[model samples]
Each structure stands twice: as C-alpha cells, then as structure tokens.
Target: MRVLLDHNIPHELRRLFPKDHDVYTAQFLGWEDYEDGELLNAAMDNNFAVLVTMDTSLPYQRNIDSFSLGVVVLDVHPATPDVLTSRMDRLVEACSRAASAREVVTLN
Candidate 1:
C-alpha cells in the first residue's frame, strides 16, 4: 500500500512500516503547509492508498467518505517514536484493511 504520513506524524515513523508498503511524509511531498482537506485531496489525487495521521479532529473536520483514500488516525498521547512503534501492528493492520476501504480507522 502507498501510505502518506500526515505532517503531524513523525517522519521517523515511516521507517517502521512494512518494507512492501510505500510510505512518504507530507513534508517530503511538499505538502507540509497544506490544510487538512487539501492534503487529503492531494493524497487521493496521487493514488495514495492510505493516509496515516495524528490529527484527531480530521474525521470531524472533513467528510472522509467523500474521498477514495483510507484515513488512519493515530490517537496516541505524546506520539513519541517508541510509543508509535509499539503500535505498529495495529497501524499496519488498519492500513491493510483501509487500503480497500474509505473509512476512518482510529488507533489509540
């Protein structure tokens, strides 16, 4: 799956994804300044299968069903690398399921 990591997610987290999954950061895509909606749209336009983010309000702020891409919202506190790493299995599972779905999956 091609996953786009939202700006709020640490760039270092990309390295934790399964090797077969293509992961890119919003900053790497030149979308560091993009608003939530704009960033999601761009990810969809670029054929990103899923968007991993730490934005808790994104689901309420945007109509996720309107887009074709899947959204995985990481609801972790502090969001440190180790914390996120401990939840990689959940993240990967959500991303895998989301690759073919357009729903929002929240991982706490």
Candidate 2:
C-alpha cells in the first residue's frame, strides 16, 4: 500500500514498514498546512491508499466516503520514542489491510 503519514507521527517509524510499500509524510509532501480534508484529497490525488495520523479529530472532522483513503490513528503516548516504536508492527498490519475508501482504523 502507498501510505502517507501525518506530521505528528514519527518519521522514523517508516523503517518498520515493508520497503516495497511507498511511505511518505505530510511534511515531505509539502502539506503541513493542509487540514484533514485538504490532506485527504492530496493523498487520493497522489494515489496514496492509506493515511497514518495522530490527530484524534480526523474521523469526525471529515466525511470518510469522500476521499477513498483509509486512515490509521495512533494512540501512543508522546513521552518517548520507545512507546511509539512498540506499536509500529500493529500499524503496519493495519495499513496492509486498510481499504481503498475512507475508513478510520484506531490503534492504542
């Protein structure tokens, strides 16, 4: 899957995913200013199949059906890299199975 990760998510987490899959960040896309809705559109336009975000309000802020981009919301504590790194496997699995259309996949 082509995955676009939000800025809040650690960029280093990309190492945990499959090298065959394309992974990018909001910062890398020059979309740091884009809100959820705009970002979703950009993702679709870029052929990104899934989004990994730390924003809790995204699911409620935008209509899921509009963009056709699946989302994975991380719930790791912001205290340290170790905490977030521990959840990388689960995130990868979620991203692998994510649908083509809009959907919110939450991970705690």
Candidate 3:
C-alpha cells in the first residue's frame, strides 16, 4: 500500500515498512505544515492508503471513518528510532489492519 509518514514520526522510520509498501514523509511531500485533517485529505488526494503517525490524538480529533485513507497511531511516548524499531512488528500489523479496515489502528 502507498503510505504517508506523518510529520510527527521520525522520517527515518520510513525504513521500517516493508519493501512492497511505498512510503514517504510529510516533509518530503511538502506537507509538513498540514494539520491532521488537511494532511489526511492531501494524502488521500495523492492516493496514499495509510498515514503513520506518533500523534495518538488524531483518531479522537478526526472522524476518519468516512475517508479511505487510514491512520495508524504509533502510541509510543518519546518516539525514537530504537524505541520504534522494537515495536516494528506491531506497527506493521497495525498498518495492514488500517489499510484493510480503513479505520484508526492504534498500537498499545
């Protein structure tokens, strides 16, 4: 699936996704200034299927059910390359669930 790495997530984390999953960061897309909803819309417009973020509040703040683009919350505090690397399995699973279900998938 085409995935967008939200601004809050470390850009380096893009390396965590599988080879088949095409991924890019908000900064790379020139969307680092976008808000949650606007970012989602922009990602959707560009045909991105899932948005990976560390901002856990996005699911509560946005009504994501109506959009085809799904949001996957990392659910990690003080997000770091090492910390996120340890949770790679959960992140990958959540991302797949988000894409297939088209809903908010939170890692806890």
Candidate 4:
C-alpha cells in the first residue's frame, strides 16, 4: 500500500511501517504546506491508498468520507515516537482495512 504520513507525524517513523508498504511524509512530498482538504485531495490524485495522521480533529473538520482514498486518524496522547511505535500493529491494521474499503478509521 502507498501510505502518506501527515505533517504531524514524525518523519522518521516512516521506516517503522511494514516493508511491503510504501510510506512517505508530507514534507518528503513537498505537501507540508497544504491544508487538510488539499492534502487529502493531493493524496488521492497521487494514488495514495491511505493517509495516516495524528490529527484527531481531521474527521470533524473535513468530510473525509467523500474522498476516494482511505484515512487513518491516530488518536494518541502525547504523540511521540515511542507512543506511536507501540501502536504500529493496530495502526497498520487500520490502514489496511481503510485502504481496502476506502473508509475512515480512528486508531486510539
């Protein structure tokens, strides 16, 4: 799967995802300045299967359900590398399911 890690997520965390999955960060794609709606649209345009973000308010702010690509929102307190690393398994699972169905999933 082609996954996009939002600007809020640590760029170094990209290496933590499964090897079979291709992961890129917003900064890596020169998309760090985009707004939420534009970012999602760009992801879809670029054939990204899913977008992983730590912004819990994204769903409420944007009608993500209307997007063709999947959205996996991470709900974590103090979203540090260690905290996110521990939840990799669950995050990956959510990403897979969301990508498969083009659904939005929140992993806490």
The segments of candidate 3 whose C-alpha lies over 4 angstroms from its true place after superposition are none
TM-score winner, 2 or 3? 3
Model 1 Cα shift for residue 9 (angstroms):
0.6
| Winner by TM-score between candidate 4 and candidate 1 | 1
Model 3, range 56-103, lDDT digits (tens) per residue? Answer: 788888889878887898888657789888988888888889988898
- Tens digit per residue, CA lDDT, model 4, 1-108: 999999999998899999999999999999999999999999999999999998888989998879999999998987888999999999999999999999889998
TM-score of structure candidate 3: 0.94
User: Please, what are the lDDT tens digits per residue for candidate 2 over residues 9-67?
Assistant: 77787777888878898998799899788889999898999999889888888887677
> What's the TM-score of each model vs. the native?
0.97, 0.90, 0.94, 0.96
State the lDDT of candidate 1 residue by residue for 6-52, as single tens digits.
Answer: 99999998999989999999999899999989998999999999999
What is the lDDT ranking, best to worst?
4, 1, 3, 2
TM-score (C-alpha) between model 4 and the true structure: 0.96
Report the number of clashing residue pairs per model.
Answer: 0, 0, 0, 0
Clashing pairs in 2: none
Largest lDDT belongs to which candidate? 4
Name the top TM-score candidate: 1
Query: In candidate 3, how many Å is residue 77 off?
Result: 2.3
Q: Candidate 2 at residue 77, lDDT?
A: 72
